[model samples]
Target chain A: MATLELRGVRKTYGTGEVVKGVDLSIKDREFVVFVGPSGCGKSTLLRMIAGLEEISAGELLIDGVRANEIPPDERELAMVFQSYALYPHMTVAGNMGFALKMAGKPKAEIAAKVAQAARILQLEALLDRRPKMLSGGQRQRVAIGRAIVRNPKCFLFDEPLSNLDAALRVQMRTEIAKLHQELEATMVYVTHDQVEAMTMADRIVVLNGGRVEQVGAPLELYRNPASKFVAGFIGSPRMNMLEVAVAGHDGAAVRLTLPGGESLAVPARDALVKTGARVTLGLRPESLNLADDGALRGKVEVVEHLGAEMLVHVRTPQDDLLIIKAPDEARIHPNQTVGIGINPARSCLFGEDGLALILRVDALA
Target chain B: MAGGTKVGGRREGRGWPLLSPAVIVLGIWSVVPLAMTLWYSTRYYNLLDPGRHFFVGLRNYDLLFSDPGSLTAIANSIILVASVLVISLIVGTALALLLNAEFPGRGAARLFAISPFFVMPPVAALIWKNLLLNPLNGLLGWMMGLFGLPVIPWFSTAPMVALIIIVSWEWIPFATLILLTALQSLDSSQIEAARMDGAGPLARLRYIILPHLGRPVAIVVMMETIFLLSIFAEILTTTSGGPGDATTTLTFLVYIRALLDFNVGGASAAGVLAIVLANIVGLFLMRSVARSLNR
Candidate 1:
């Protein structure tokens, strides 16, 4: 096991900077995922860490040693590319044993190691077949087997499951999680899918436009996002954001007028909020419930009947759209008026600067 | 229903009528000449004595097999094609790898490297014969003089070697162009994976790049063999099968017999022999090299 640290790592292509001063410390045996939208510099950062791309300006430390000038092979890291990158000409066993052969290991030793890795990946039957002869899932296992034979200090996955179909991606996702548990190696994975990040990552680093937006545990990022960007990004169906104007602030809480002219009290200190100031109110879909005596009113525009739950799209009188998660059996229909109830404790408040304001303890309770 | 069936039969008959133009052109261009050649090869025909012709079954073939010059021509043809293929493939692979790397002026350099392939065969032969390898005052002779070395006569002394060098120079660009295109299509991530697997440059080249290039290289060999067997203009323009028939290949021998000696029967027999040889080589290459690639 090894700890990986990136100190102010930067990458620039010609004049355009792609990865801007990303600083992170990954602990031993930790599964850290870099998650973001397309062109968010998450892949670039991962490549830099893999030594596939040069580190433009900062130090990459592996086990407290600077490894900026180290070649990828010498860096003691194995990367699983999205394309799988298996040697098409060689058999599965040959591909797995290639590194050992290149390092001048004896034939018997290489074969033994390859056999062990095949046993681990359940690829013993495929050892004699070439990559072109294998299915997509088998090729993926061969790719992992190739990495397993190396026994590197850390494993880097560059969106490894992006090419698989939906069902297979889910199956392989669990398999990878199990592999991590078995190997217990420090793994760094990059993907644009937040669900993968939420499901597989021990800690998730959310990136946007060449910069890290927030880095925290998946649930921590889901529960307490640092900015409006993260709040909208971390959760499925997206967190509903409504523009609000502060009506007034009491000594312990701030009273805000929603877009539909309804007022609610949010637990925010007076110093962090001001009277007549504008802010965005963040609420997850699950945080909003349907109540008979709720104050806020909206018309249901659409109803999505998922098997386990129902997603109700509501349009308020202020013309703002909000999604509410309801039970599958909930009787919701389009063109019907409904009340949306918000729990103040599960809500977040973003100031004019887009930074999350401190929520008072009473509201969190 | 009878009228409709008649009309459909008429329409079906129209297909051959429409296709007759291409068929007629191919018959005149290919089949008629081949038939004429086949007829002439079985007879004793001489352009110099057209009225004294007679059928001579297998006599011309027997004469060709018995002629010592025919054996030399066959050997020279095999040597020329094999040497050029070997030299071009090796140099072309190296040049393709060099051009594949990231460097300034790479585009212009690639264009320059492939420029020789576009040069006319006769023009390339003449340029090498007169300006490059002429023993008296050629550039190579001048370089030899500068080094105080003997300025040996290239074409006169080493005609086969000179022919091989000139042909390889012209054909290397073709091999390089095809191989370079194949090299460019290689997935970069595969190379990166190999590198991450602790493969150095040599190992990567051996295990990845060469294997990826297998099909294209086979194609290059097949195409080059087809063209290399019929190499005529260069031999005609430069050596002319001189120096005691040292550089006389099968096609050159055919030209000498048909055009110079006017021996129609003998030339036709040799032409048929060349076709048989080419087909045998082509079949072997397809079965051995191309099939192994499985492209």
Candidate 2:
């Protein structure tokens, strides 16, 4: 029954503010991921929640109680660091049992708890071996086993899988997801990998420059991003944004001229856009198709053929480079001139401030 | 087999030539003196009457083993080394932990903590004897006078303790610097993990910090033991084996036998014993280091 609430929480180091007024609520047993690029203050926010970093301002509540001044040990939170952070001198069982021993648990209780955690982590056979004798994945499991033995209220993971190889990372990702189900504990994970957030999170909070850009389910963020930054960041093979001039507005829909002088209309009933005002148009690569009467014309510059699909890099008439996902069997060649069609209903329009313009369904049709 | 033999032959041919100069220098510097000492230990050699020397076999060694002064010297040597090792290791670890914490003036504090290591042994002994612990006009004497306590003559009454204090002061910096470096190399994330695991300060030190420092502490002990086994300069400068050989360590006793009494054979036998003792300790230290490395 652990829940976390942050009210205008901030972290300032000297004159530079790293986490600026992050207000969030994490539900009980929810796996919430803080996803962002490097230096986006995601780790700092997690550290603050872990009570490892001091909150420069505002409040943090755990289970409906004010916990800003509490030390990490008393806060009942466990963090798995990227480096695993296992004690090299101790055996796996010892490392897992240290916290319980420190809390004055009897030797039998500590050993029993450690044995249970080792069994859960499939580390029973390795309990007597020191950390240096374990492989990277084994060490990581020991770190998690150490955390599990404590049975904290919340689990915080700071890029825990970033140190593993690509194959190991995917394996550990599934392991972590399964662990979340087994424990049913509230977990706050921080990572720069969008795919990890997309696959593992119940909800992902996207941050940029120490501010929360958007928060939603993975597909919701992928389908309907709230900002141009989110639209570009949340999706693989990122959405291409082109600068366009507003042709006119018909009170219900706004019309814009593309870079190649092709005009398109988008639903923007709530957008305060003026005629002749320059705005940005966002088009996902998958939303594009090859049509005989397509308005946008471009020459294919490069072709990357994956097993199921091909990424077509196109140069438009306006010299803008764009990516188009084509069917794998479609034998496209470089320097081939083609007409690329954009689906306006599946597109997005951003104002000069990079804020997404709310779209009405009828106008989208 | 051919490939292995070729590689081995090439390595032997190239390595031996490259190592020739070092081997030659070591042979001249160490082996020659050792051979001379071995020869001298077997005869009644004396600088005072070189022409009257005779074959003594193990007589010098027997004399050394039976001498009450040599026994006192051996005991004093063990006491000094053991006391200095204990004091420096405890104080050094504490200082390292203190310096590892973030605080104002930490850089300057570390500089001061490591300054004594740079002081030469004789100079350090002199500074302690004259400026810090002297019975008449030293700072400690003045402090005792202010408290209405009698000034205790350190070298006269507590010569071994005085020597231990002086040696520990000089060696503590060496231990502190090594331990501090080990402390710095400790993964901060591990400490943070310990905190998150419900361990407080003392728990973290007991379970994490001390265990992590094991290898570095072993190294410090090994190095300090090697140097402390033959500590001569401090005693020569300050206590000079004291009022009744209270602080006459093995090295000082050998110096007295060879230079003062001109009993070269006796001194050489003592030197041979010191070498054997040092080797036993070195073997133990090497085994510990090797075990840690394997771990």
Clashes of each: 0, 0
Residue-by-residue lDDT tens digits, candidate 2, B1-295: 9999999999989899889999999999999999988998989989999798888899999999998998898889889888999999999999999999999999999999999989999899999999999999899999999999999899898988888999999999999999999999999998998888778888889988998888888888888999999999999999788778899988998899899999999999999987877888799889998786566
**Per-model TM values vs. the true structure:** 0.95, 0.96
- For model 2, residues A320-347, the per-residue Cα lDDT tens digits are 8889887876668898998988887777
CAPRI-style grade of the A/B interface in model 2:
high
User: Reference contacts recovered by each candidate, as fractions?
Assistant: 0.87, 0.92
For each candidate, report its DockQ versus the true two-chain complex. 0.82, 0.83
Task: Tell me the tens digit of each residue's lDDT in model 1 across A185-300.
Answer: 99999999999999999999999999999998888888888889889989999999999998988776778898878798876555377788899999899988888666578999
Residue A221 lDDT (model 2):
81
> Which residue pairs clash in candidate 2?
none
Query: Native contacts recovered by candidate 1, as a share?
Result: 0.87
lDDT of 2 at A203: 96
**Model 2 DockQ, alpha carbons vs. true complex:** 0.83
Clash pairs, model 1 backbone: none
Q: Judging by DockQ against the true structure, name the best candidate.
A: 2
